[model samples]
Target: MTGNHWGYGKDDGPTIWHKNFPVAEGTRQSPIDIDPHQASHDPNLGPIVLNYDHCTSINISNNGHSVVVEFDDSDDRSVIQGGPLDNPYRLKQFHFHWGGKGCHGSEHTVEGQSYASELHLVHWNAVKYKSFGEAASSPDGLAVLGIFLDTGDDHRWLHMITDALYMVKFKSSVTDFKRFNPKCLLPSSLHYWTYPGSLTTPPLHESVTWIVLKEPITVSEKQLGKFRMLLFTGEEEDQRMRMENNFRPPQPLKGRKVRSSN
Candidate 1:
């Protein structure tokens, strides 16, 4: 798994990830199935607040794993607070996971039902840690907001990112993508399910305080197809691999209690 050798293929997929990153089988691994009926509703939980009014988005890139839109988190310009968080977490980057044609590919499922795609807004606890890398390894150092994307009418704001997919179709490609605010990607309701979990990808660090929104945002198949056009292979590679079904299946709950926002 060193030097980005891992992928969603038969030989090197999620199942075999633990061989390299043993934390993959950790107790708090993410992308767990969220059972609404089993989740306890917490009236004490406050509304999740996102302050992206002055957010500075720098660029977008294909990092071999997913298309990531990075931000300049040097200051507290854009951050998420309230809800299950004790302090405002600085927005670092956001990426997505999706399925192939006519397939559901969300990471975290609802009552075992999967969505077409899932969006992750990664934030670091700048108040406690000095850097994003430090925050990622420590427990309670990160907060990832998960938003499910269902198939339907086109999302007007999503085109901003999808339109740029062609520029970074190959892995390790990057291009200028400034002033794009992710606030537009949020659903109508901030009501969500909260739990302690790890990253869905490798190095499955169990440091994230997960906040998954209840309502799903709708995006047309046409828009989602734009994501599929992206290639997991680099431009130099002879083998062409379409980036689809990049999501990890739901992991075992392992007695973890999911809490619902009031």
Candidate 2:
């Protein structure tokens, strides 16, 4: 009903991204399929071993279709070994990529296929943004650490995310459970897909330096339904099914490159 927290199938479908938020067009996006022809063999990048400690209570917000997480003070120590030592990027926000009950939801398909959902650990170059949105225009402003999702039996895996789904449904709604860390959500292996791409959502800002994990974490069907519950109610009056297909349409390949850590 309001300007924010749009699930899927509404007037502002994921495809009409650029039209909804004029500023979104200015920010880098994700969930793009990689073109093998353009995918380069960059020596500087490989599987990034992330060493994050502060979780800051994995808070989520429904920015129309997908949810975005805001990390309190998360950083990246997984930069390419010989690359920049002090990672100027600070974990700013995060979100997910999901499919229906029984399918893939990954953004970058492996040889043309999607996963059930992908978890994006979005960060901003502190060297750029005094505030999160400040660096929306800078090409090197964002660094997104992506992890894949699969079905699993451990309920602990959903602890940080599923618990806080209700608070951030709409704009200006904040949820803080307690002090937490980000390292717990990750697995032992850090293999991933790296690339330079635009935002998967509208406005399509091309400022993100992405690192997508090769391995995926699994969740039970009941778990994903909880995420759907995040947007079940709208504006205190419009209580429609708010979680219908909140995925963004794939973007034009437009001459970019993708890298991998496998």
Q: What's the true lDDT of residue 92 in model 2?
A: 63
lDDT values, one for every candidate? 0.93, 0.60
RMSD in Å for all candidates: 1.4, 4.2
Report the backbone clash tally of model 2.
31
Per-residue alpha-carbon lDDT of model 2 for 1-262, expressed as tens digits? 2345333465656655556665444423466775555566666664454545444544556655566665665334322221221355666666786765565556666556666677777667666467656655567767777776677675575766676776666534666645555566776677666766655654456777777666767677777766666553346535465453556645545455666554
In model 1, where do residues sit more than 4 Å from their true spots? Answer: 1-4, 236-240
Report the alpha-carbon TM-score of model 2 versus the true structure.
0.77
Q: Deviation in angstroms for 214 in model 1?
A: 0.3
TM-score of each: 0.97, 0.77
Model 1 C-alpha lDDT per residue in residues 23-65, reported as the tens digit of each score = 8988999999999999999999999999999859999999877
Q: What is the lDDT of candidate 2?
A: 0.60
